[model samples]
Every structure is written in structure tokens, then in C-alpha cells.
Target: MAGACVAALLASSACSSSQDASPMSDSSASNASQKLSGTVTVFAAASLKESFTTLGADFEKAHPGTKVTFSFGGSDSLAASITGGAPTDVFAAASPRTMAVVSDAGGVSGTPTTFVRNQLEIATRPGNPDAIGSLEDLTDPKLKVVLCDRTVPCGAAAQKALDGSKLKLTPVSYEQDVKGALTKVVLKEADAAVVYKTDVRAAGDKVGGVEFPESADAVNDYPIALLKDAPNAAAAKAFIDYVQSAAGQKVLTSAGFLKP
Candidate 1:
């Protein structure tokens, strides 16, 4: 009887040890990995609205306990904000030049990676009432053209394109961001606006997009970096990694943004 009891006890101990050694279920593992909670503030260029917003949602879904908040505006303005002490976790600029502003100030932690590229386009009211066809059309004195402020990436790119075409033109208004420039056209406040192609696409039928060859001269390369003082550094790095992933590439390309 004693021998039989000892053998049974050994078998029970083995079963307990096996149970302890078993791997956690996939759901439990996911829950454990998703313990990253709290808000991740992202400052991205205005042009990245669609794709970045989609990625933010995906990131949230991937990390159930975490939340992503965004501040989208002109890249230069956003970079300034970061440098000026506006609390931010990630900074995604439309131009490396603008990002250099933050990098120069040591506002970010690591090297910024170029994630996407964009080109300028003329955004006009539906039907292009200005009869705008090329970059020189913007030189028409009678046209009330709006452009992104020269400080903004879109505006800087527009200047490059204009310089490349050797066309001297001036805009009636220099808005803070591409969206502001597009809004002027959408609201008929201006005849046209020099904005990013993505902005024109986002505006849909509200505006007509005119692609000029000179835009190639000012194709902007977007770069993203994690802020040095990121409140959520771990989640910030994870978000940046996700943005460079294949899934994120699909979302960005679907929005007409070029792969990096």
C-alpha cells in the first residue's frame, strides 16, 4: 500500500510540474505585452493625417491599455512646438530640414528615419476656375493664390518648385499649413493654393489637384523621431517601429504617400 501511494504521489508531482512549465495562452501573453498604458502624444505634419490617424487607431488596438493623442500641423510649426517645450513623445516632420530644427535643439532622442515622401500640387476650387494648368499659371496677376507659409515644409517645397521653374510668383496669403491653404480654396477664399498632393487628395472633390513637373524638384522626405524627454518612451519607440512596419507601409501608400 505504501509503495503504491509513493508512486501515485510522484505522478501527481510530475503533473503539477508539467502544468507549471506550460506556456501561457496567446490571449494572456498578449495581455501581458500590452500592459503599456497612458497617453502617447504625437506631433505629425498636416499631410500625415489620414495614415497617421489610421496607425494611431491600429496602435491603440494593438495596445489595448494605451492611448495615442496627436497634434497635426505644419511640420515647421510642429517642430517649433517641440523645441519650445510643448510636451510631445514623437515628432514626424514633412521635411528633414524642419526636423533638423528639433535635432539641433536636442529635442529628440535618436536619429530620425525618413518614412515617406511627398510632392507639391496646386489645389484649386472644383473645375479649376482659375484655368490653372502649370506652375507658371500661378504667376497670373489676376489669380488670388494662397500658399503654405514659407516656414512650412509645403511652402518651402513650393518655393523650390517655383525656383526650379524660374517663375517669379507671389501668393495672396501664406497660411500656416497645407490644410489651411487648401481650406482657402475649399471655401473659395482664394483662387488656388500650393499644397501637398496628399492635401489635395484628402480634400477630395472640394478641390482639383494639378500636378506640375517642377514638383519633382521639391519632393519632401518625411522623417520621424522620438523626443528625448518622451513621457512614454517605451510606447513611443513601439509606435515608431510600427509605423515602419509593412502594415503601416500599406496604410501610408494607400493614402498616396510614397514609401521611404
Candidate 2:
């Protein structure tokens, strides 16, 4: 009878141990899965500078001990760098065509997802000093106009809009990025520039924005993806998720970006 009682106690102890060793609770497992750390490096288009910077700051706050670094420039240039083996965690391009440049080169980890879309706008000097109101007005030889280089996404979109409207514009100079084109108007170096609507909004009182019907024809979709050899894949993916989350969308939409 004593031996029988000893076996019963041992079985009870074994059952208790089994219960204690059961799989972690769902919440515990989720928390363990979400733990992320390290710096996430992003190569992004110049147009994303303001919005992405805001999102990056919010991401860092949400994930303690993680950092987000950005290299903002023309999407084409950024894609070239990535394809050339530049070490980065993520790439956010201003347009699908530019994103394709990386994907075709096998520099991206997965399919690039479109996150937002942007439309072209005429950025003019403050208070309409040039009185420029339409795409045709830019054709006047008297205005000192600046345009993005045709190779850049913004420039390409502008060309599309012009072509759709059957309009031809000659600019005093061509800039390599949207920011460069907008800066010409902001500094009053150029009377007007064709840039992204978001860029005009970001400039605040520094420049005035003119919307033309043709802009609808030249809307550019922005895409984001993880690079093939990301050094910080976990953090990079977390940042990308945050960018697509409701909180991130709120910040981006509030900044004048259109939802994809």
C-alpha cells in the first residue's frame, strides 16, 4: 500500500510538471516574437525625407533600443547604389519603375509593395510673384523655371503631365531631385518649378503650390521593400510594418501624401 501511494504521488507531480511546462501563453509568445533591436538603415527617395523622418522617429519611440537611419535622394540613384551592393536594410522608392530597377537586379528580398502615391504640382514663388497659374504659363520665356531631370521620378512625372496636356516647357535648369527643384522656387532663384504636391506642402510658406488638371495624369506610386542582404532584417521589417500601420498612415496622410 505504501509503494502504491508513492506511485500516485509521483504521477501527480509529473502531471503538475506537465501543466507548468505547457506552451507559453499567447500574449507571452507574441511579446517574445515582437522583440526587435538594432539600427534599420533605409535608402529612400528625396520626396520621402519629411514623411519618412517623422515615421522613423515614431518607430524608434515605439521600439526602444532600435534606430532608423535614412539616406534620401533620387530613387534612381538610390536603386543604383543598392544594386551596386550598398549595405542597407530597406528601400523606399518614389515610383514603381524605380523600384523595378532594384527588383530586376535581384537586390530586393520580396515583392515591393506600393505604400503611397504622389501627384505633380507647380511650386511657385511665395504670394504668386510670377502669377503662374497653369502648365501653359510655364511655357513663357520670361519665367525662370526649374524642372527635375528627366531621369528622376519627379521629373519623369512632370514630363508625363506635360505630354498628356500636349504642352512643352523649357526650364532655366534641371535639378536631380524634387527637393532641388523645389529649392529653386523656395530661394526665389527660379520663378517656378514642377515638383511633387507633397513637397510643396512640406515647403509651407516657403513656396506656393499650383494644382493643374494634368497632375492627375502623372500621379506616381511609391513602393517599399526589404533589400536582399539586409544586415538588420528584423528591424527593417518592423519599420516597414510601422509605415503601413494605421498610426504611420495617419502621419503620412496628414503630411499631404495620398493613400495607395
- Each prediction's total of clashing residue pairs, residues at least 3 apart in sequence or on different chains, is 0, 0
TM-score of each: 0.91, 0.91
**Per-residue lDDT of model 2, residues 207-228, tens digit only:** 9999999999899999999988
TM-score result, candidate 1: 0.91
> Across residues 95-175, which tens digit of lDDT does each residue of candidate 1 receive?
999999999999889899999999888998899876899989989999999988889889889988888878988789899
Best by lDDT: 2
Q: All candidates' lDDT scores?
A: 0.90, 0.92
Name the runs in model 2 displaced over 4 angstroms. 1-30
Q: Show where candidate 1 strays beyond 4 Å.
A: 1-16, 19-22, 25-34
Error of 1 at 74 (Å): 1.6
Model 2, residue 257: distance off in Å is 1.1
Clashing pairs in 2: none
